[model samples]
Target: MIRTLIGALGGLVVALLILGVLATFGVWDSIGRVASILGGLVLGMVFGQLGIFIAVWRE
Candidate 1:
């Protein structure tokens, strides 16, 4: 469970980093601020679930 939590946190961090880079490049400008934020959250959730799955599978 701890490992899974760590994986999810790591995934969230990675997602935020990716979002930051895209925002820096003006990729989210057309989408607007709220939509961009929501998208990032959704992306983070997906990555987090993937991380959890990997952690559980490895064990």
Candidate 2:
């Protein structure tokens, strides 16, 4: 559990660093619409996978 937490935090840090670089290049400014679309895509995938697993587990 602790390892999972540490790994997640490290991943977040790396993501932030990459975002910082993108922001410096002005990619952040144009990412508003893309961000929403990507977030929705990821959320859909995550929940969809969870729903699939639960359905299968119920069998």
Candidate 3:
């Protein structure tokens, strides 16, 4: 359970980092708010699942 929590947090950090990079490149301006949010949500879930998989696999 602790591993799962750590993995999820790590994933969220990664998602935020990617979003930050996109924002730096002004991608958010072209995409609009709703689309950007949806993109972030998708990224979060994908990365979160990947993180969880890796964590569990390591066990």
What's the lDDT for all of these models? 0.70, 0.59, 0.70
lDDT of 1 by residue, 1-59 (tens): 66666666776677667767777888865647755676678677767777777777898
Candidate 1 lDDT (Cα, 0 to 1): 0.70
Please provide TM-scores, in order, for all candidate models, with all chains considered together: 0.49, 0.54, 0.50
Per-residue lDDT tens digits of candidate 2, residues 9-29? 555566556556767788876
After superposition, the stretches of candidate 3 with alpha carbons farther than 4 Å from their true spots are: 30-59
lDDT, candidate 3, 1-59, per-residue tens: 56666666676777678767777888865546745675678677767777777777888
| All candidates: CA RMSD (Å) | 5.5, 5.7, 5.7
What RMSD does model 2 have? 5.7
Best of the candidates, TM-score: 2
Q: Give candidate 2's TM-score.
A: 0.54
Q: Once superposed on the true structure, which residue ranges of model 1 sit more than 4 Å away at CA?
A: 30-59
